[model samples]
Target: MTAWQSIPLIQAEFLAGRAEPRVVTPRGDLAADEQATIALFEQARGSVVFIATTERLFNPWTRNALQVPRGTGSGFVWDNLGHVVTNDHVIAGASGATVRLADGRAFNAVLVGTSPAHDLAVLRIGVGAGRPEPLPIGTSHDLRVGQKVFAIGNPFGLDWTLTTGIVSALNRELPTDTGAVIERLIQTDAAINPGNSGGPLLDSAGRLIGVNTAIYSPSGASAGIGFAVPVDTVNRVVPRLIAQGRYIRPSLGIRTEEQLNAALSARLGIQGVFVLEVEPGSAAERAGIRPARLGREAGFQTGDVIVSLGGRPVRRVADLLAALDRHAPGDAVSVTVLRDGATVDLNVTLDAGR
Candidate 1:
């Protein structure tokens, strides 16, 4: 018999002899760093929240209404006044939502404002004495690659989940729902999944550094790559959202293609934003800016191509918008365009964008 075959007999003999039990209590202490991390998680957990949206679906056969789940995502407390910030896409097409706090309290949320260009939205909830404190805002401009970061969010319906990673990169660009590009995004290796959108990306001190926004994955799950809108941008945009009910971007009052890539530019023998159309009675039209026109002989004659705006080179639509956003409405700027193979400079005043 193998040694294993004798175990039952030995156990029975020991049990009959009443052998002493050798049970031992286990005890261990977490390291100081781990303890600190735990403390930070505990501190920041109160601010993160789970958001659920519901939509009314009308059933024609039943002639009734069905309230169904629209979507779910995460958000964090923006201030003491009950303003919660989240991803715009999270609430996109959602008529109404509910916010659930960590302490098991749920509140009906009203959409205060949204900047679809930045993928950010602010919602307001009626406050009581139990309102959670907002997360401390931190600076993302000084962040370095490999710096430790933490993400607190509700990933895949899991509420108040914390995931840790380091800054994988910085100054990344992300396209938003409005076709505008959000620049200077924080890229991290945090495991941000679908439901994590609009949650807080915190630092070691539990300060909000970025807003968890997107994850790069082919499987619709985390692949060790995640992106966040830097807190600096949030700080600048959130206030306007709360006050104005919309974020007004500076505009040059012209229309261009959604994307003017290098290949298309090369094919058209143009090196800048092709002006497809200019708004009538706007700055571009007032400044004598020409729009592309159909030609009888040349087939399609490109209008004045915007090569630069406010002395900044413009190669695409996003670049032009970015350049324009640097200025304010009513600010006069020098717009340089390529007209008939010649560089022409026009002075135009920036306008308030929708």
Candidate 2:
């Protein structure tokens, strides 16, 4: 009967019933790098925060104003004084914002200051004795392209998530929605998404190096490319924002519109910022920098076209601003301009801008 059905029925049943759970294997200690990363997260998680924004809307039916959920992002405790730092775009149009700490404490945040051009903002809360410690700041100017970096934020509403990557690039320039360009940005592939904006980008030592700002993705998600505002800029801007309620940019006291500069550059086949009007008694005027004026014979005549500032080329309005940003007010700089097809050099001391 075909070898008696291979075996006895009782034996087959016993074999099937003998099956049991497998033994669990013990996992060894984590690697040195793994342990360090885990330790870093545990130590720094308290400094990171989740930010929820709301906008006020008036309902026609109820004839009442309502606070609707606007958006959510991430932020970090800036200091023990309850100053929370985040991206300016995170709270651009929101009527109010709430900051939630890692300890599950939520506090209503007040807008302290904002620098839209730098994409940074500061908020204040009354956390009192329960304030989380601020992150340890690190210099971004010394960061190498291949060094490991960590990002902690609430990505896609996922709270307290961590991502890690190497510094893919540095000194990158990015344009903001406010039509201003932010220079010296740090680029990484750290899985930074929408909610990651305003969160801290830390180094291996758990020191803050940058603020995760934007992602270069077409799908509205992380596509292996992300940008952060370098901590050097943050350090220079945030304290000023906290104290002054605004970041004052250094100005040359010369007015130049972007559209007009572009048109004039095209017409003249030149690549520089055309000084539209030099403010009277201003730095430009003091430096003998001329401005475009109405000409009787030529209809409209272009004056001095700024070619360079402090040895840095100024081709667009953004370039000029960025060049000026490198120096503080009262600092003297060499300005080069093209006047009547001849290059001229002038000295100008910057002034504080509004």
Candidate 3:
């Protein structure tokens, strides 16, 4: 047979002898709840941004200046005038920072204000164009445990990552680098990490409920336990930061232990804060609040025990702090203290904290 005639037969024989491999592709529709979650993410993702900070390093040996990356974190748009909010530790030592939106746009950000006590900070970028939408603010007061929550941020340098979990707890407290305690924190299991700090923690309705601040991970990664500063604290602190560059929490001018314990109160025969030392010229001092004293007769006599303030029971130091925070400086509050088996009432004008 001719070569051309044999070619077709050879090709047909090879094709008929070969086995075909099956290829399968799987595609399924998303569930309704998943669709809603996707929609929520879409609605709020634009408000989130990645923050990169820079610090100037002085090289004494080279006699030259160099700018190096300080760190990276996440932040969200706060207002139309270009206010961005993030964790204070995000920009802790950064000389400057840049805010980058999801659309690949970046801007130089200047520090507006910072409150290390709450682990919150505000940054400002000039308004000209391409400003991300501000998040819809929500009140954390109404949030219940086990309610669905979402967190969007850069985790391990991965930007725009989303994690979903329910509110594990409320009214939690976390310590800040400044030795101040952040109160009324929202605890969640929504996979937060180092880069997730300062991002928004939203409810299922896409409203901002808290600011992701810390994680309870021993390995420096998300261990399914995280905490955020509740919006109630955020609302109170942010405005003050924007206006005054710092948050001034109300104070009674008395210093106590890191926390008040029931044993301490019981030993003192009082169910209130046992005054350790009242400031020399503080409102507490003016109100005749006394410090715990050492007595020869009683061995160790409790000077004064504050039982209540402004009609609110002060069972612990936190209660006293929360009560004081409700009023501003110069506001007169009625303080009741147990003094020598008798209850005494004193009016004290609140003073600014030192």
Candidate 4:
């Protein structure tokens, strides 16, 4: 009997999370039939999958038939209560979704809520008799470029499939099915496939730092450039989805334009968002974020040009939007800006922008 811990990469990848199937007894000698049988057993024993099963339709003869719902893909049990978190796209059209856990257990999962903007979803698994291990949450805020990362999910009905790679990039942005931009994303080299969506992306320490959400291959497989929703965004968005069915976004109320042309640039004498107007009684107004200088020199200006939020420098409207996206309604932030050739700081209370 050999303890599996003796193998470094395979053992850690196995215990911490599923990394990949190890070809065991590579150097050992066994009869052909015996070796083939053992390899098959180990291969099947190594992975976990998350799936969304469709609501079964009843036929006259087999109304009582217990039809097994289809497995979605690689998903981990997020908690003992049987709530599972996965990518929203995985279960998008499924009327019935179920989670397939290790030990060959399948449970009916009700869709709790989802954030299409973030591509994250939550589902409740246990109702009759099942509780699963929930992975510990970790942060993506401080994740470095070379940090090892692991992904656990079912790829193409395969259960508990694990793939390993490193944090390939950070602060990635890509458009969803809709044209809306998904911001502050984590780019990794981890192998994510058709069945890998909604699986947890874990660090070497075995803590979840992101969720496998998208891949770059046109062929719909891992192209060595996969993206995950940073666990930090998940922490902010998921709890709200669990408590309430939606998320609240914070904003600094002002109409802005990106600086582009030399004419507008020279006219304003500054390069930044051209503030058109600030909503009266909004966060910006309260902070006395000065409306654009109107009169003869400035043309039809009424809004304040916001240059920064919470000390993060903002040179464009997207920058301002990104900073506000990180905070929720009622969070107060200090805004810095350029006004009349002077850098001024203002405190503003974010509004729950509908």
Write the number of the candidate with greater TM-score, choosing between 2 and 4: 2
Best by lDDT: 2
Which residue runs of candidate 2 sit more than 4 Å off their true CA positions?
Answer: 1-12, 252-348, 352-354
- Candidates in order have lDDT scores of 0.88, 0.91, 0.87, 0.72
Stretches of candidate 3 exceeding 4 Å from the true structure? 1-29, 252-347
Q: What TM-score, computed on C-alpha atoms, does each candidate reach?
A: 0.72, 0.73, 0.73, 0.62
- Model 1 stretches with alpha carbons more than 4 Å out: 1-11, 15-28, 251-328, 331-348
Poorest 10 consecutive residues by lDDT, candidate 1: 255-264
* Candidate RMSDs in order: 8.3, 8.9, 7.5, 13.9
lDDT, candidate 2, 85-162, per-residue tens:
999999999999999999999999999999987899999999976679999999876688899999999999999999
Q: Give a tens-digit lDDT track for model 1, residues 67-110.
A: 88998999999999999999999999887899999999999999
lDDT of 3: 0.87
lDDT of 1: 0.88
Displacement of the residue 87 alpha carbon in candidate 3, Å: 0.4
Worst 10 residues of 2 by lDDT: 256-265
**Backbone atom clashes (below 3 Å) for every candidate:** 0, 0, 0, 21
Candidate 4 stretches greater than 4 Å from native: 1-49, 55-71, 127-130, 253-354
| Deviation (Å) of 122 in candidate 2 | 0.3
